[model samples]
Target: LHQFDPQDVNYNMPSVLQVSGPLDVKRVEDVFCQLIARHATLRTRFELIDSEPMQWIEDTVPFAVEYTKVQAAGTTADTDQDTTTDTYTRVNIEAQQLVSRFVRPFDLQAAPLLRVGLVDLGVQEVEQEAQHLLMLDMHHIVSDGVSLEVLTDEFVRLYDGEELAPLRIQYKDYAVWQQSEAHQEWMQRQEAYWLNTFQGELPVLDLSTDFARPAVQSTAGDTIEFALGREVSERLKELAAQTGATLYMVLLAAYTTLLHKYTGQEDIVVGTPIAGRPHAELESLVGVFINTLAMRNYPSSDKSFLD
Candidate 1:
């Protein structure tokens, strides 16, 4: 935000929830609204006042869940022109259009940076089978991945006609607590540790690349996935036990070791996310409660892998 404009309209978080079953549209809408009303963060918007930012919570946010029908393959009439093929092609085209809108940036000033859409999977009034695709688009400023899981759980419970207990405090209450004098003092106490940890000139990681690096950073990216075999996974567990450390710690040590071998830089700092919700009451709340902690590793050449 310090480097870019606040209203750039390029920052957004999107997720899709695929649900297959009997879908009650009215019930789902009511439960969705209840979910937003129960959580203050969902109904929050940011604004600049006196050159500072402040959160504005709306009493009610607009219901923006759109419903569209997607024709099922082999369900169309058997005409000479093959109506089923035509229907399938049309549905695929419409679905792509919906996906394009799903990634569009949201307006931060608009309260409730959430929009939902339901895609009917050939469910008609006379048909017995019912299913839907729940599309969700939200701004990262107001939420994170954890928020998505919380909402999904609540929606399922509400759809099952179960009552949810009222929250004692909301995210706004936490924000207010952060401004207290005691909190400021607590925050200051950690300054010395961070300062000492990052002392001296930071080393730049010169990664070996196949192509020239760009002058400006870009969000355009993709992910690759790989999995360790069962035997290797069990060995990793055994290694963690011998070292008296957790699996995560052992894996992190291995990662830092790999980086040290690749870049020949032992003073490595790796960033990992931690859930900032320390209180049990805040666990079920839907909000962005995460902080990144930099883990500095200085592996010695004399020590073994367990070290």
Candidate 2:
């Protein structure tokens, strides 16, 4: 998909971390370099090999932190008290702009799809601590949410001068195991289960919208936020416990009920992401190990919530 749509930035996972007190820029850069050296996915790139798309992991990749120092804006003699607040605001704006620019599409054929940037906001007299914003951007092909957490934890450990234990296995080892004959048999069983589940004609959900459907599908959309109060949340949890179902199952039931009410569809299929790390060895590795699970549910007006 990335190869076809090279301009899309949707797969770019960007994160920002704020560091307080004094910071060593060189040490931070070294920490990033160590992280790349530790994780094989960090040095991976994709290209066509024998007419098939394949990933190649390089032994090493050059990495450096792009540092930017933000200067405080001039303050009038009368606004000395507001200088700290004003400086913070200015730093925030500059940091946001830098992140926006840093989050661009990556070339799949290029190794080290990761980019790091640091913004030094200097020291504030009120806080008496220097602040720095660290930005990390990586392609989704090489990393996922869990991988980002691993990177952050390892980064902190390295910066604090703690030695990390060598990994027993890398992502490449996991990939090799996935193609083994034993894994193939297990995968075939799963394939059979899904084939049986979706054998019949699937129902198409048709929810009424304000405007006519476009000729082509679009990634553009808007989001609305709503919260279930504490009482309702607790009640839902209690219901889940009583019914021996997870909170996710209970919430999914409610969501499907809403869809049935809106579209009058009895059968609905929804897709949700699942962490695909099945082995203990894969837990600490930095890689894209996520899979989508398709859930098919039947909701009827006559059935109670429990049913």
Candidate 3:
């Protein structure tokens, strides 16, 4: 009980990759999957063990990694032989795969969360051309925004022969512990606090999202992503350090300020995903231990983005 640092969890979304280069795609994929399967949480699902969602782990999945490889319309170049593939891509819609519903495991499985598709770049003959493509798709449930970075780093380390350390806990334990930690008292307090803060605010943002969809349409919305560069991100970290506040607080403040300016509302409420993991054991597991809630902030004309 001296110190317990748990891993963060993420929502269930299909995380995808499009790799184009003059390389040995199959071998690269094989190595990638092998690295992921070594982690325990990636092999687990969630179960309510003792009134909490814990990692309901299995010995292994039938196919630890699901490979979806599609051949391109050209001669395949040898993979691992890095050739430039700096190309813009177009989007095509297809039916979402059922694997989406499977509880996403972390990279610690007997095999990585593997899916492969051979992309058809359709590049017909050219000079300065030695290009091939390999695409890997992973369910985002196992890959949090931060965990993406971790996965990349770990992948590189594995390829570079860096020795890996064994993780102490899996996602299954985290699931159960989370529920236990969120006892009636905590929920009551959280409800009271959130209720007071958000009760009187108007809606924020101009995204115009809908909470409901027709019965046939499963999901109601999509997402847009943008990142803050090092300079701004570091400034935020500095502010948080000085004020002894969390990044969550700062982000909430920024959203509030943005809303007040955009909506001309003094009080604004916005919803964000919160980690539902409360117990120490839950820190390491993967599952849907997240929820959305509205936050309220006051109106201010001069509130800067960083304020």
TM agreement with the true structure for every prediction: 0.89, 0.91, 0.54
| Higher-scoring candidate on TM-score, 1 or 3 | 1
Per residue, candidate 3 scores C-alpha lDDT tens digits across 64-175 of 2344332222334652223323122111222123224333433433233444444334342333333333334444545454444445566657655676676666554554
The count of residue-pair clashes in candidate 1 stands at 0
Model 1 per-residue lDDT tens digits across residues 142-234: 877777888889989999999999999999888888889999998888888898989998766666889767897777789999999999999
Query: For model 2, how big is the CA root-mean-square deviation?
Result: 2.3
C-alpha RMSD by candidate, in order: 3.2, 2.3, 9.5
Residues 1-307, candidate 2: write the lDDT tens digits.
Answer: 8867899998999999988899999999999999999888999999998989999999988788999988744444465667757776877788789878888989989889999999887775545678788999989999999999999999999999999999989998989999999999999999999999898999877889987778788878898999999999999999999999999999999999999999988999989899899888888999989889998898977899899
Model number with the top lDDT: 2
- Looking at model 3, report the run of 10 residues with the lowest lDDT sum: 86-95
Output the worst ten-in-a-row residue range by lDDT, candidate 1: 122-131
Residue runs of model 1 more than 4 Å from their true location after superposition: 2-10, 76-93, 123-129
Q: Output the lDDT of residue 110, model 1.
A: 82
Each model's lDDT: 0.79, 0.88, 0.50
Spell out the clash pairs found in candidate 2.
none
